[model samples]
Target: AQASFSQVFMGVAFTCGAEEEVIPFFDRGLPVEYELTRSIRVVAKTNRKKIGVLNTEAKLFGGFDFQSMRSTPPWPVVDELKKQYDVEQVSASEPIEEEYDALLIALPSSLPQKEMDHLQDYMEAGNPTLLLVDPLTIINVGLSPSEKAGANMNPFMRNQGPPPKEKGDIHALMTALGVSWNKAQIIWDQYNPHPDFAHLQPEIVFVGANNPEAFNQEHTASAGLQELVLLFPGSLRKAADSDYDFQPLVKTTPASGSLNYSQLVQRSFFGVQLVQPRFGHRPNPAAYTMAAHIKGESFPDTTNGADSDTTQTPTRVNAMVIADLDFISQQFFQIRQQAVGNLNFDNVTFFLNCMDVLVGDESFITLRKKRVRHRTLETIEEKKREFREEQLKEEQEAEAEASQALAEAQKRLSEKVAEVRQRTDLDDRTKEIMARNLQEAEQRKLDALKNKIEAKKEARIQRSKEEMEAKIRSIQSNIKVYSVFLPPLPVLGFGIFIFVRRYKREKEGAAAARRLRA
Candidate 1:
């Protein structure tokens, strides 16, 4: 009966021109019901997932500006996120209306108890989330109420606010996730300095790839990042009781130290001295985790009786915690005239990569990764750079010397012509003839001098090129020689070893036979 059933299906598949599709069902002997279920699951997996941006307390998009829904300059990170995902602004006061796959919480100064409950509920339901927290919040103190409400807002307003205070609910959430957030301290690295923006405070921390302790190359989010500039970034550490797998994505250099914001503020203002020194006082300079990834078992669904089964397998939960929220803000991306939307930086790419990894959607990671194109020349060895500089200097000196010699030759020829023209002994006709001859002689000398200088310049350039090529060729030749001979050396040694062992064994066997015969 089974054979007959298979034959009937095969005939039907051939008639329907879907033999390949039917063959899979026949091979697995899957019922029609199972095939339909699998098809639905495949389609669901391919669909675009929604992302929720918590704007109620976080104000991630921007503060409560009724005129413009988005922040004045608008957050560039949101613009990038919209290109690939359906991003919806979610309020913590209301129940989440959209079926979002992930949530993004931009630096929130404060969250009410109700809002914190909503976030906790969302996270406990197994939804992935990314939290960008700031250790300090700077408010614009210079803007008046009228100027703030004006249509054209100045982007250069100076922001002066107190140090970042820890939000009780946010701290509780971090503890639950097994991540620790240092509320009182901010990171500063002496080894990695940033281009001074006069408007920004001295506490702003800048970290680059050159500072090995600051950049983690092992994580996917920060793998190819070259530099990250954080404005008053906080420090993060994993907690002992956390159940998730924790990995540091970004860090501060070994020269970095955590400064107490309260102490620094007292010293900056009020003319008070610190009781204890702040620099180089720690026993060991350690790299503090600036960003981290935590993954673990998801919360079980309790919406339905069947879903509430304790024996059911739990889903995987992924969350990314970044200490610096201002790093990805519009203020950081905008420099001078360039707007936040146009400027490309590693921080933006890193944020997008983190989002993609959290949601298990890597489709946009490659596209976003292409945004960072800055190639720093600092990677070149100092010796090689110095040699190149010396070559350039030699060329400049040679050109200067040739110019001086040409000037001297012209001056001498001009003086000789003047001497001949001024001679009183010569008659008018003779003087004119001698003057013409002298002018012609001067022209020939000038041309010869120009040619000589040109030849010298060309020779110098050619010599430099030849020397560079020679060095490159010498390196290549050494590599080639090793490539050709290195592999064969081991093989040759192994062959000789095997031959000697076999020869010795054969002789021993013959001697044993001879001894037995004797």
Candidate 2:
């Protein structure tokens, strides 16, 4: 207050390290106060805990791809880390050195023996780490070698999921961390229904752990998280009689089911399955763990080579494992905050909290990401939202049904083509010609079918939408009129009544006074 009003002031000053890159505090991932404090601390102590990000096929740190003809930037999460720590991509093939305070391994798979040993040693040493591995992600299938070289791989494209070989223990680091992830199964949460195929169906395949109770409320990493969206996440459970305690961080309600890995990845087969609920019938009801810590008693026991005959000793596995990578990917968590820079969920906050937990520094965990607040008309929006969701779900179900039909038709056509191609009587040219004709025919038929289904869906949705829109418009119009003029009507009426009563009372008093004088 004194400085604001008076001339006396202490000039502000901050020192930057000789090697550290200096930038405005706004770009620093921490809150202004924390960033100022951290900057002050850096002047005295230049050393900061390093955070290593092992790049996967997804290419976390993107660059201009000559092949894809696109320039991509690092994800917001990674960019934030770079501003605060010595963030760099670490290779799995190399020895795990640099003494990273925390390591984030995404899409890990098979590992070389040497890398495996290094990773095992690193985890056993009580380093905080987070692992995100997926068996079948709908995001984009693995990018082409050339495209990945350019670092412009798009994950949202519909294509075949990663091949078995690309998943060399999927970062080959998951196995080393003692985090058991099944490269074969994916969870399908039924309670929080977000169906992938909007086909006409009663069953849903998309997984969403949307309840607060499903989160480990006591843990700082997951506390206050109301929901987590996972596409096809695997369950985190103890591996085959392994006693290592699996403390769950995120869980699915009993209404969750597991889908077949191979069948789900193949588009046609998966679409067909979506059309028909195979897993939905069995309806396995268990609170499956989607994310957890592999630590304490459940840690794998290892015996020193010199003492082979001795009993194995347990080591703390200070690691947190999340089954799906998309939850943290730019598409899922950072979607809403992209354009408007407001009204985002706690996804990024959850990630930041996990990072702080792993890095053993809670300094920035309480600070939220950049956000802008605005007012919304709740009365109108509430009704509109209800209608909009219903309409979207209906449309999706219709699309799912259309997709299933197309898949079946294509499957039949493919089987027939395979049978025809096997015949040796026809020359290569004839076979090629037949194949082309059949594909053309298949395209025409599928397009017609898709159009037919789409038309129907649009017509139905339009009708429902029109009806709802009319009702909403009527309600809104009424609300507007009432809001404009109805607010003061009661007050106005009450004032008139009070005036009339007062007038009557005063007239009676004057008449009585006059009668007394006469």
Candidate 3:
């Protein structure tokens, strides 16, 4: 699932094949190992799972916009989930009409207390929930900078104040479940870079992670996932009084910090810094939990005064809590002006895997979590970098040495010309002619020296390139030998040893039988 923007997955089943980069030199698909190229067939099942959505604000399930007086189209996430699950929008104000396999609550803190009670009733009844919480969701998406900030970059004559920032803070619900989200702050992860807005030098409210270290391999939902895009994400932490297991599935890098609104607005906190201190900074860098899975029995406190039959049994829930909701938004993942299905990150796959695992799709989970290890040829790459630095230094040294030699030669020629001018036996014309000859000879020598220096520089660069190439080839050959041939050697040796042991046993048995007959 570790994919750049230019790569895509190719497999028989959707989850079987790994991400493949289309190498330009090959003009075809990337050449991978047989296991990576391998795929398994998928058979569709009739009994699809059902997932309930609680937020109509996210427009996940398209609904009529009263302001626009038109029906807004549904998002791609709804369409994707509809393929495997029956998705329905549930009202927050009313009680959940029916029990579903799983429920999606986007921005859990935005709902009212009445709605939260309803959700508690549903969860207390043993329904699972995939809770997505974001610290700063875009209030007015797709608006120009003037419309967003209410002014251009001129920083003058701003009449209206900035729009109110929406945060997700569900202390009661999180306490009942397992974790607490610090919604007042956004997570700033320098582990991955968001490529856009680098030119504008705008505030880095956007954070992304495309490294394998960001995802926990021990967890099934987050395993094999490599990329996630987040906008103003929050941090998830275990509640002090909660007994549930709050295991982190995704984490911010140790280079990250829980950035407050003040830190976000400060220009000093942005861009690459030569010296970064985690010790006494306003917010120290730490590995905060961006996404997690909490497992335990639902606390009976929120279920009180509800219609749910709490007396039956304690509702055991396995819930996934994410610190960001923008990843699921189309504007965050979908590439504009391209195909609607194309994505810039693997957030959708990660969400789908979470849903699948929550719905208890064991077979699908198995395929999605199947990870194949591969090499990056770091040795050859390291050698290339080393040789480039070495070659550059050698060229500089050669140029300096040639320049010194030319200066000395010119000084010697000047001395000889002065000596000729001082000679009494030669005429002035002869001296002039002799000096001219000396000057021409010195010029030729200088040109020769320059030519030699240039030729040596080129040769040295070429030699270094060839040497690196040869070392890379040798490493590649050794890898092939180990992968293709070395594995069989141990098997062949074991076979020969077994054959000799069997031969000895048979001979001894035959000799014993003969002696008994005699």
Candidate 4:
């Protein structure tokens, strides 16, 4: 019965960047997914199911309540979704194990490690988990300078040693999940740059593979993701064996190669530290840094759980790592117009689609249709606004044109009256009579011209009314949603029966009239 009401309500969790991007992408049309949590409860009938949502971070900003934080919340996407789905706000720490059919995790680098560990457990249980690991920062722990600066080109003489233990720990964590991250380089690409950054000299070479086979075609994660940016030096390679079914989803172009960590660090974060040769001997043309989805088993848990029934499940895990983490910063989000190449949507969408894989099919279909309808309606509205403005301008110009034509007609008529008054070929009486008749005729002509102008104005008004009606009808047609409540099948059949009976009665009455006439 709730589905009979034409609306979807969405409760958005403004807790993470990934969620933020995901919500708007689906609320409006683009190749992205919409998420529902326990925080928002959408009303659904037999076919429609309410999506429960949880606002994990809603409590921190305000009290442990969502309704109180409504005044200043910035998650408009959530609000838009609420119009179609039910929204609920919940704590971030709570595990959304079975409240909803699907899940979307948009945890940024700031999410707690313990939460991520819980998420890992969830994924191991065959639930879809989309992981986004930024190379620069993950959960606020970035690669230290000492960890990145190897012996190859430590021009600044910055202390260099074997990479830090934490780096290895991060790698081990990723490898256990079939994904790894190398913090040694920045993904420098020749094709893509923030418009402001494009003019500067790019040193660290990054490449996104031009070939289609570079990515896994079968996986849901890489769907519609055409390109990726990676750093040149110290990039993560595919550690899994070739026999492993997991495939590389993104790679660098052939002309690109990795740079040493020192050079990239010096150029990117630090001002120019070394002033030497502008160019150097290039290494391999390209190196494989980031790869997605290597099929493997989960790492054995060493916890001292006394329960004998506890068992780990073998499931396919999706992983993504880039050499640079700064790509997700606010700076990059601002480069929509200035950038020559692709932007972050490629990476954002890849992770989003993967999460959608974890969600229910009906939810995904509803979101897709809603997005298409909403965006199309918005575009049509914009067009209508523009058309109305143009029509108003045209009407004003036509009125001005009519006024100018009347002024010219009056001027010519006045000149003819003056010419008749000055003529000497006629007698006084005849000239006077002719002049009076000409004056009356000109006045009548003026009134006739004014009537014509008024007629044109009325015609334009009627045309405008008809046009507006047509536009309204078109919009109504677009809004006409199908529903069983709209004239039931039995009701329609009964109406047809009554119409046929009335037609037969009318025909019998016509035959009686013909008989009386005969």
Pairing residues by index, what is the TM-score of model 4?
0.39
Which pairs in model 3 have colliding backbones?
none
Better of 1 and 3 by TM-score: 3
TM-score sort, best first: 2, 3, 1, 4
Query: Taking the tens digit of each residue's C-alpha lDDT, what string does model 4 give over 1-518?
Result: 35565655342344342233224332232323334432232322223333433332211122322222234433333443344444454333556466543333322223344454555555555544334444333212223323332212233533443441221234444555555455444343333323344343333332322344445566555543444433232355555632224566565543334444455344433322333222232334463545455444543443676454667544545333333433333333333223424343344344334434445433343343222211134444444544444444545555676778789889988998888989999888888898899989998999899889867865774576468547855765655643445647779899999999999999999999999999
The residue-by-residue lDDT of candidate 1 on 58-149, one tens digit each, is: 35565654323354544767865764566888887765556677899765335555676677667656678998776654432111111111
Candidate 1, residue 424: CA error in Å? 99
> Candidate 3: misplaced stretches above 4 Å?
1-44, 64-71, 139-169, 193-213, 262-283, 298-315, 331-344, 366-518
* Winner by TM-score: 2
Cα RMSDs, all models: 21.7, 9.9, 18.9, 26.7
What lDDT tens digits, residue by residue, belong to model 3 across residues 411-491?
A: 887898899888899999999999889888877887887678667756765676477557756877888888898899999
Evaluated against the true structure, the overall lDDT of model 4 is 0.45
Candidate 3's displacement at residue 346, Å, is 1.8
Q: What's the distance in Å from true for residue 75, model 2? A: 4.5
Instruction: Give lDDT for model 2.
Output: 0.60
* Tens digit per residue, CA lDDT, model 2, 351-377: 767777888877655544333333446
Error of 1 at 242 (Å): 1.1
lDDT of each: 0.61, 0.60, 0.61, 0.45
Runs in model 1 lying further than 4 Å from the true structure: 1-47, 63-73, 94-97, 139-168, 193-202, 266-284, 298-316, 335-344, 371-518
Q: Pick the candidate with the highest lDDT.
A: 1
